[model samples]
Target: MDLTNLSYEEGLKELESIIDSLETGELTLEESFNKFKKGVDLYKYLYEILNKVEGEIKIIMEDEEREEDFQLEG
Candidate 1:
């Protein structure tokens, strides 16, 4: 499957499948390494998306808090 083009949920599902395949001890060494690489890429992509979302939320909360403080001091 093309992990790069996958949606977040689809990428996560595919990563889980790769883990299961590796844990089964059925694939050859090369195949295992390839799956592992794909899993890592998926993980990195998900992490980046989550981090950006978190950062945006943090900025919004900080702005709200500043507004509240100004209201209190006015």
Candidate 2:
């Protein structure tokens, strides 16, 4: 599966797997570094997606309390 094309949940799961692999110290240094890089990329992608969604929600319901609403102007 292509990490870049994965949904938020899928990316997170893959990132968790990468973390497990790194923590186990079973992979060669190069492999570990590659996986780590991919994990970071996935994490960033997920975070950005989440931030955008949150922003959209805030925009959509500016007046109402959004569950545990906090000011999120962006």
Candidate 3:
């Protein structure tokens, strides 16, 4: 799966599918291990995306506040 191309919601859905598969207890040991690894990778990718979005939102909010302050001053 191309994590970079996936949105946060897609990543989350994939992660949930992985969890369901793991819970089924039907996979071979090797299959389970591979799925677990994939889940971890998906989790990390999602975390990074969330943090980046949060930072961008904070910056945008700060810019808006600065603009409002400037307008008030003027």
Candidate 4:
């Protein structure tokens, strides 16, 4: 599956489904391992998206703070 094209919500939903499948103990060993790896990849993708958004938020907050400081000194 192409995780790169998934939205964060979609990736999260897929991960949850993978977890439920693993919990069922129904897959062959190879299939379980493959699903596990895919789940990990989805986790990393979601994490990267979260980190990027967090960085953007920090930058915006910093800019706002600087603007407030400048206004106070004006």
Candidate 5:
């Protein structure tokens, strides 16, 4: 599965499903391992997306603060 295109929510849901499957112990060992790998990949993708969003938010907040400072000066 290509996780790169998935939204954070979608990746989280898929990760949850993988956890449920592992907890159920219904899958063969190899299958479970494969699922685990996929889950890890999804997690990394989600993490990267979160980091990008955080940086964007910081930039927006800084911009707002600068605008406020300018207004006070004016």
Candidate 6:
């Protein structure tokens, strides 16, 4: 699946739908496998997004800490 333009919320919604469908036991084995694979891709994409955001937050926090330290020293 080409998730190049997919937002995190959209991907998450799709993953949830996949899980719901899988739970119903309605799809054939092949269909289930396909959904499973797509879900994995969505999960990875979401994880990467979260990790990037976390890293950015950490950087901002570190910068704030440095500024505070500099002010104290001055």
Estimate TM-scores for all models: 0.82, 0.76, 0.91, 0.95, 0.92, 0.95
Looking at model 2, residue 31 earns an lDDT score of: 100
Q: Total clashes, candidate 4?
A: 0
Residues 1-74 of candidate 2 have per-residue lDDT tens digits of 36567788887888899999999989999999899888888888889999999999888776566533655542
lDDT of 3: 0.96
* Candidate 5 wrong stretches, greater than 4 Å: none
Pairs of residues at least 3 apart in sequence or in different chains that clash in candidate 6: none
Local accuracy of candidate 3 as per-residue lDDT tens digits, 1-74:
68889989999999999999999999999999999999999999999998999999999999999999999999
Candidate 4 backbone collisions, by pair: none
lDDT of 1 at 69: 100
Put down candidate 5 lDDT per residue, 1-74, tens digits, no spaces. Answer: 87758889999999999999999999999999999999999889989999999999999999999999999999
Q: Which scores greater on TM-score, model 2 or model 3? A: 3
User: In candidate 1, residue 2 scores what lDDT?
Assistant: 57
Residue 69 in candidate 4 has what lDDT? 100
Model 3 error, position 37 (Å): 0.4
Local error of candidate 5 at residue 49 (angstroms): 0.8
Scored against the true structure, residue 43 in model 6 reaches a CA lDDT of 95
Q: What is the C-alpha lDDT of each candidate?
A: 0.88, 0.83, 0.96, 0.96, 0.93, 0.96
